[model samples]
Target: MIRFEDVSVTYDAAPGPTVQRVDLIVPEGELVLLVGPSGVGKSTLLGTVSGLVPHFTGGTLRGRVTVAGRDTRTHKPRELADVVGTVGQDPLSHFVTDTVEDELAYGMESLGLAPDVMRRRVEETLDLLGLADLRDRPIATLSGGQQQRVAIGSVLTPHPQVLVLDEPTSALDPAAAEEVLAVLQRLVHDLGTTVLMAEHRLERVVQYADQVLLLAAPGEAPVLGDPAALMARSPVFPPVVALGRIAGWSPLPLTVRDARRRAGALRERLAGAEPRRATPTEPTPAPGTGRRWAGLRRERTAEALPGVVAASVARLAVRRGRVEALRRVDLTVTPGETVALMGRNGAGKSTLLSTLVGLLEPASGTVRVGGAVPHRTSPRELIRHVGLVPQEPRDLLYADTVAAECAAADHDADAPPGTCRALVDELLPGIADDTHPRDLSEGQRLTLALAIVLTTRPPLLLLDEPTRGLDYAAKTRLVTILRGLAADGHAILLATHDVELAAEIAHRVVILADGEVVADGPTEQIVVSSPSFAPQVTKILAPQEWLTVSEVRRALDAGGGEPW
Candidate 1:
């Protein structure tokens, strides 16, 4: 349904074309998966089909692009709304209404559909996307995953033939993401709608892809072909496939089930081979000294508490008019500990977070933070101890300069001189102090916002999906910074879908289902034991003791001795 012929798009600010001479075609009713590194113009390509590139974004177009027999250059987004639907990574930015039902009906209303048709389509979309239960809830009260689904539902209500989503499930938890992917599969199979999506979480959706489009870095052409063949040859793929290829497995497995089926055959071929020696463990420091320090830190945190809880909730019953949002929920956080809140979308993860921060008032029950209740605490006073990096980074940034923005977070506080400045410098160096914050890249803006939050040195830190748009290297850096903060005894709470990150940094994991904690325990035990969670590479390869890649390498070296 979509075709790109010699498409080369160049922005005025960019020295060269963001996407150059890209010749591609998507057959009608085909599900195509687009994969590439960040900032490689993957989204730019998707914009061509939706008529957002040369139309809304204001760029120079050099080639012809058509969608459903309509030329993109001649059609605006509104004009093509009936033929094509687009959902972006950030759902909040696209919302035009306050309630879920209203948002879902927005597109149909825009198309001038009859009220009866709009009502039927809205109900059908809600059922298809599993948003019926939340149809009456406020859009701001939904979780990241639910909001994203709502965004998709809003677009799908018009019955578009083609759906183009950019990283649709990036912010969703494993189960939530699976749910969204299942809906997409149904749309393609049952509804016969064409789909073209760009995502970084390849392992999740790659197995179901009908075709794969691998975009080479800028200045090179895109590679398009079969999914399995592309995954086998592409360097950028899930680790499991990489291992399968290295082991020389024929017709390599794409999913875990496929790997399990051929595992016995693969193992038999290498049976006679010597077992590889295991990697060495990290040296244990004087055990008693480490324990003493940990004990002392805990004591210090406890003593600092003034017998008043930083955050507390009792019988917190929140409702969306009639339906319960949070049913008699109760939660608390102490002075120093990192808590990971997890659950499927619409299970009140974001609602609970918002209640604690006083953004959403509970329908019933008390919520106390540092002796003052949520509704009772003034916004200025709440800023003293609680700092939140919301799901949308753009919501928090309004300042002009990068340095000025970070400094603003501590404008009224008594932070040490140059502390905020130093924090910003550490996070994103070489970014001009005078440069506009909006002009920075997405990753750069995320870093700047994080730096701003850290400037206050709040006792409690709450981050919701902090790793949304980060690349692999950026994610690693964020892990390091968060670990450092946790070690310093900051009571950190992260609501995220990043299982690997939860395994690596969090000391504790709290699984939420139906607005309550279903499982709470140490990170290692929960992640390693839970089947739904993706096991870290170290845990999978060396299940006994290793958790990180470096640890696994060290263990292998100790067992085999240093080859070099």
Candidate 2:
């Protein structure tokens, strides 16, 4: 259905082609997964399918690109609307109507379909996407996951044969992402619709893909082949694939179930080969002091307060008119602790975070930050106690320079005038000091935002999906910064679907289902023990008593060569 013959796309302002010499063919009725690191032209490749590349983005294109036999250069997005359905990473940006039903019907109406046809298509899409109950709900009130589903439904209502989505589940939680992927799988299996999707979270979606298109970095050619083999050799792969590569498995496992089976065989083989001695346990630190020592010991210890509460939500209930976003939710956080807020899309994770930060007033119940009501506190006063880094980093940046952006958030009036400059310089290096905040790369912008928020040195820091759009290096940088802050008495609450990040950094894990806390406890207990919420690596390895790579490495080192 889609073909790219030596296709190259160059943006007006960029130095070179975003996608260079790409030759790909997506066979009809095939579900192809496009995987790569961020900014490798995955979105650009998808745009060519629906004529959004040279048409909407104002770019120069060379070579031939065709969708369903029609040349892309000749067909505009509106002209190809009948043959292809395209969904972007940001659902809100693509929305044409305010309500779910209207959005679903808008595309068909634009095509001048009959009223009966539009109504039928709308009803079918609502049912297929499980949005029947939320037909009349405002699109703005929907959760990230729900909005993404609505975006898909709005495109699919026209019954296009091919569907192209760019990081459709990037904004969604695991459960909600699963819901959207399930729908996509059904559309391919039952409805015979072709799917071409680009996603970074490969562990969740790789098992269902029929083909894999692996794009290398800029100036490199794309790799295309079987999903399993590509994952094993690819530089960017999930933990399971990494394990499979290390284990020397043939026809490597792509899913947890496959990994589990292979792991069982490997364990049996090793057990039969030799008898192993019992491993010695390491000495535990004193009750409250974790593993920190020396210069950082005092800061780590100060993070643990005996009786001080950082944030509290009591019987909180939020409603958008008649629809309840959150219902009677209660939670609490303490200083120096890292709490992970997890839930499927529409399970009220964002709503709960907004209410806790006083951005959204709860219809019922109370929210307290450091024993003071968040809603009652002034915005300036709240800045000293709590700083919220929203999902979209673009929303927080307004200064001309990265240095100026950080300075605007500095709350210390008595401090030196160059304090913000020093802080930003310390946190973010290599980024030009005078570069426009909006012109920097997404990862750089994210770092700049974190630096800006940290300038205030807020006691309670709330980050909503900080890992989105970040590469491996950027993610590592973020983890290092967050760890330092958590060790220094800051109460960090991260709302994210990146389970690996939670396993690595979070001290506590809280799972929200239907707007209520279904599970809450230590990260090890919640992530390792729970079946539904286990991290991908944990599911594959099932180590005796470790949740992170560092923990596993420590255990292995102490075991004297025993496998963890």
Candidate 3:
């Protein structure tokens, strides 16, 4: 269905060719997963499949590319629309119509399908993607995850032969991700639709992939093979793969069920062992790097941090148009505490974050951060008490360069001039100072926004899907920074779908459903008990309380049992 013959693409401002000599064949009805670190040209490669690489993105494509036996070099995006459906990372940029129903039918209408056929396809897509109840709603009024579904539904109605999605489930909750994955599975099995996806959260999609494409680095040819064989040595992988490596399991498992079958001896070894005690301290850079940075120690203790309340909410309710996004939710977080907010898509997780940060005023009830009401506080006062890193990280960035952004942040926070710069170094190492903000990758942009927020040293920090596009190394750096903040009496709240992240850093867990808090408690008690919310390690070692691979690795290192 898709073929790339010695394809090499270069951009005007890039240091080198974004992708070099990429040759691959994606058979019909197969799901190919594209895995790589940030800024390694996954998006650039996907654009080539849709004839958007040099055609629409103003880059240079040097080799032959074909989809459905039609040469993309000669065909424009519009010409390939019937066979290729491409959904990029930013869903908000893909919309034209106002309502969900119209958006789904627009593509079919463009293809000049009969009115009756368009109507039938629209209804089928609405039910296929679980968007029936939202058909009449305005696209702009929907949450980020809801908008993502609308964007995907809009393209699926075209019945394209191949689907190319960039982080399709990044904004969704665990169950919602499962739903979308299930639909993709159906499309591949029942309809013989080919799929190509690029996702940062490997834990959610790795098991469903038919083959793996690992772009080791920029200007390097991709390695394509079986998923397990590739992930065994790949730096970027899920917790389940990590656990298999630690246990020395042959033919490593891709799913929890596969791991669980081979986990008997591994479980026995860790039965009597306990996780190591973590030494929480600030990170120091290599030899003579001059400044301290945030780095993670990985062995985060399971015990909750105790301190005074940093934020509190009582009977908070939020509404959007006719949708009650959040119910009468009551919540609280204390200093030195890290809490994770989790739920299905459009289940009110974003609404809760918006309410806490003053973006959405609750229709009823109250929200207080550091003893100050968020809705009533001035900008200066609010900056001191609370800071938020939004889902769309660009929302917090407008400066032309990284240096200017740091300088402005330092002036606003009244901190030393180099404070924000050091934080940026800690979050995203080796990023050039003179580079334009728009030129940075999605993950780097988020890191910069996070650094800006951290420079303020706000007592209450809130992040929405903070690890959306980060690789393992970058995510580890983020883990260290967040753990340092929690240790220093900063109350941190994260809204995320990455179960592995919640497993490693969060001390408490709160699950929301239909705008109401369905479950709230310690991280282990909450996540390990739920099938959908459990992390990879917890799923493999079920009936036990294990939550992360690091914990088990620590136990094994402490003489849990002999290795196989």
User: What TM-score, over all chains together, does every model reach?
Assistant: 0.80, 0.85, 0.93
Which residue segments of model 2 deviate by more than 4 Å? 265-307, 399-448, 542-550, 560-564
Writing each residue's lDDT as its tens digit, candidate 3 over 255-353 gives 989999999988777777665422213222223222243331211211122336789999988888788988789999887788899988788888888
Top lDDT prediction, candidate number? 3
lDDT of 1 by residue, 124-228 (tens): 888877888889989976777888889988988988899999888877878767877888888899888999998877767888789999875766678889988
lDDT of each: 0.72, 0.75, 0.84
Better of 2 and 3 by lDDT: 3
Q: Would you give me the overall lDDT of model 2?
A: 0.75
Q: Measured by C-alpha RMSD in angstroms, how accurate is candidate 1?
A: 6.1
Error of 3 at 342 (Å): 1.0
* lDDT of residue 17 for candidate 2: 86
Model 2 error, position 332 (Å): 2.3
For candidate 2, write residues 106-154 as lDDT tens digits. 9998889999999888888888778998898899888777888899889
From the highest TM-score down, the ranking of the candidates is 3, 2, 1
TM-score of 2: 0.85
- TM-score, model 1 to reference: 0.80
When sorted by lDDT, best at the front, the candidate numbers are: 3, 2, 1
